[model samples]
Target: MSDFAIGLCGIGAMFVLMILRMPVGMAMLAVGYFGTVILNGTRSANALLLTETFSSASNYSLTVIPLFVLMGNIASAAGFSSRLYEAAFAWVGWLRGGLASASIVGCAAFSAVSGSSVATAVTIGRVALPEMKRFGYSDALSTGAVAAGGTLGFLIPPSTGFVIYAILTEESIGQLFMAGILPGLLLTAFFMGAIAFVTLRNPGAGPRGEFVPFEERFKALLRAMPLLLVIVVSIGGIYLGIFTPVEAAGVGAGMVALMAGISGNMNREQAVKAVSDTVRTTAMLYLIIIGASVLNPFLALTELPATLGETMTAAGFGPYGLLFLIVLAYLALGMFMDGLAMLVVTIPIFFPIVTAAGFDPIWFGVIAVIVIEMGMITPPVGLNVFVVKSVAEDVSMGTIFRGVLPFWFAMAACLLVIVVFPQIALLIPQAMFR
Candidate 1:
């Protein structure tokens, strides 16, 4: 068979493995290794696997993954995340659908520290959902907000998605992080607007929460200051050139650890649990990165990415038209695939097409992340939806999916606005790096 045909078969096999409930990292690794063996003998395949494994494991920039994960895990175990959610609730809980809106706000704030959609959803949803239910909010609206808001973890600064994209595309992590800020905030606003629309259409769905006195709100905000401060120093220091992303992550992790220790909120047991969780999560990410590293060369050898690029360019759809189609394709894939797996698999194929069409790489990173974020809440395989379901065990999957539907449109609108005004994704990075 032709090399391109082999590549197509390898991809089909990867999907088949995923359907059989195999881990994404292992599926990619297995496909890449065997595909290479088919094309170039066992020696080259073994060498490729070993070299890529070491290269990915030793990548200096990737240290940020473990450090950031530690920071978030420590914060969660220490109750800092709950404090952050409390502050958001105190400030926004009085509005119509206020509890739900507060959940979005909390998700955005926690996302700055966590950088994982599942983490964000679990951290905020655990606290927000019970309160929303107590206040007579519908499960769909309550669950939907948390799931949608959790996606901000992939878009905000310290995002794992941007970090992986940067590694994959050789783009600057700081620049991509900067690019994400405005778009992340923009999507958060759109999500809130979605809540308002839902609550307006059916007042019974979301009731207004109690008015938190100004003094109490101030106190709640004060309690949340530790995390807010860490977020600013870590993410803000990067933009101001005071720290590289790696240094920022290390510093942030140290600060959170100190706070947790001093406050006595993280006991020895909790500390061990936090570190164990960090290691586990970091290992999984490393495996996926290693798998991608192996798969990329195999795909390159196949010349499939190049062939597809040529075919698409020859189709006469200008850059914008091609972009529209790519977005649609991502949306379709999002329905059934894991977001990170989709990202790793598709970037090798699509990045060249996007950059070749004259789109800025950093801007495109932001755009790709937003589309992937949308997938986190998309149906069937909506990862965030599943995370929310795990938290709200009594709530049906259908109810959660129904809840996330409006937010899905909110995501679409956010994507549209960024597409039309590329500046939304580019402005910060340009201003900072200029």
Candidate 2:
């Protein structure tokens, strides 16, 4: 068979395995392994697999993944999440649909420190779910807000998605991270707006939160100050070159550990658990990266990405047209694959073509992360939705999905804003960094 034909066949077979419920990392590795053997020889394929695995594992950029995840886990264990919610609630919970709005805001705040969608969702899910329930907030609204809001974990700074993309595309990590801030805030605003609209539409949907006096609201600020500092240092520090992204992460980890310890949130046991969780989750992401490495070169040999790009170019589509197609693809895959898997699988194929298409790679990274954010809230396979679902047993999966629809629209709208105004994504990165 021709190389192109083999590549196409390999992709088709990979999807079949994925549909059969094979793990994404394994499916890619399996198809690419055999396909490499067919395209080359067994010896070449074996060497390719082994070398790819080793090189990918040793990549310095990827080290940021675990550090970022560790910072998040440490922060969560240290109880940053609870204080964030408390601060947000005290300030906004008095508004109509305030508690739900507060949940979105709280998640966005937490997303800065905790860049994992599932981490944000599950952490906030545990804290915010009960509060919403106690306040007589409808399960749909409460659960939906958490699921949808958790997606901000990707769109916000300190994103795992940005880390992977920066590594894969060789974009400056700082620039890509800066690119996400405006888009992230816009998304957060849309999420909050969606909640306000929904609860306003049906007054009973979100029960009013007990009013906190202005003094009490002001007092709540002290509890959330640590989070704001982390955001400034982790994100702002990186932006200003006060530290590298990884160094910023180290600072975040240290701050969380100290604060958590000081707050009595962390005992030795909790600290041990935090490390265990970080190591386990980081190992999983690394495994997926290693598996993708095994597959990418084999796939690269087929020249499928160039072929696809040429076809798109021949079809005479504009940049916007291609961007729309990419977003649509993410929406479909969001129903099946997890966000990181979707990114790792698709970036090798899409990155080259996207850059060649006159799109900015850093800009593309922001847009791509937002696409993953959408995936985090979409049905069937949204990790965030499941995170909230797992915690709120009384809320059915379908009901949660139904509720997140508004936030989904909100996500889409934010995406549109970014598409129309590349300046929104690029401005901060350029103005501050340049």
Candidate 3:
């Protein structure tokens, strides 16, 4: 009878649909749409649907999604990801536990261009896993590194999840992007350190190697010049006020396309595949946005966020405690849900509470993304695990699970770092916006 009752029941039904193996977006769209219609009657729902669809489809901020995705797809197809790995591997592959550390660095570089966990895991796994196996790396370290490293795709720039967060919260997309850079690099470092420690403790997981010849390493590094150049220009341009976020996205896509075309890597077939993938991914994102549109009215009507915020604030939790709870909830839900779908459903509810708790929107956006990274490696439905699983077929599921455990801990450490010193997350935005 009440709004909360309908909402809770609708969410419950959504879980049932998920258990039945319905697509997440479709289930949410169906449940949220039908629930809105029930709560507001058919007439209001239909009218709002028409209005919301038109406006949401044409929204300027929403356009950032397709551009970022296009940039990622083009960069990937152009062979930029491989170049990044080559450089990272040549330099780091000689260290103690070198190959595994190289994979983390490679994944971080690839994540700079491709924004999805699936793409990151698959791309790097295709390139790095075989090499790690060849180098006598343990399946645990090899598979685990790729899986955990793939989660970086969401943390690095051009991140689709970060873009979606901006759209949902109506935060500045530019600020959201700048917020990701430091944290992304820090997490990558954490993964590398964890790999080194594991290898050092038990050299069986990895093998130390002679340094790569400076000449060969430099040559290999040269192979990544295009990728490095593009990343530097795109992210730097955005940060320095030289380009808006949307414009920066466009430039990145164009650069990727040019590089792919010049290098003869992107044939007509590859181009088609890239476009098709981009279109499909873009459509799915927009549909989720539309589904949120259907629920937006209900969000307003419920007043649930206000009540919940008051409830939390009154229970003697400060901003930090409330933040801890929100992050924890994200971690738990991530176990079974897709990251994007989880964001779509939960953000509408908790984002308000987060803002009420006196956090900056830009800072909170970074924190939310870091939390999602933990999900991508968590068991059951961790998308990164699936990516590696699909690529490294000989690896059992347990190996991949064990592999990600350290990275998960590293992700937790990254979170703690961000929580303790908000400046790590806030500095870039403050320096830019101020």
Q: lDDT winner among the candidates?
A: 1
lDDT score, candidate 2 = 0.85
In candidate 2, list every pair of residues with a backbone clash: none
Residue pairs with backbone atoms closer than 3 Å in model 3 (clashes): none
List TM-scores for all candidates, in order.
Answer: 0.99, 0.97, 0.97
Clashes of 2: 0
Candidate 3 local Cα displacement, residue 56, angstroms: 1.8
Which residue ranges in model 3 land beyond 4 Å of their true spot? Answer: none
Local distance difference test scores for all models: 0.94, 0.85, 0.84
Q: How much lDDT does candidate 3 score?
A: 0.84
Ranking by lDDT: 1, 2, 3
* Per-residue lDDT over 1-434 for candidate 2, one digit per residue giving the tens place of the 0 to 100 score: 78888889988898899889887788888988898999889999999888888888888777777777888888888787888999999999988889988888888899898878888888888888898888888889999999998888887878888887876777888888888888888888998899888987998889789999999988898878987888888888888889888888888887877778787977888789999999988887777777777778878899887888788777877777887888888889888788988898889988877887888888889888888888887878878888888899888999999989999999888888888888999998898777
| Residue-level lDDT tens digits of model 1 in 1-434 | 99999999999999999999998999999999999999999999999999999999999999999999999999999999999989999999999999999999999999999989899999999999999999999999999999999999999989999999999999899999989899999999999999999999999899999999999999999999989999999999999999999999999999999999899998999999999999999999998999899999999999999999999999999999889989998999999998899999999999999999999999889889999999999888999999999999999999999999999999999999998999998988888989
Candidate 3's residue-wise lDDT over 60-164, tens digit each?
877767877888888778778887888888898888788888888988888877778788888888988898888788998999999998888888887888888
Compare candidates 2 and 3 on lDDT and give the better one.
Answer: 2
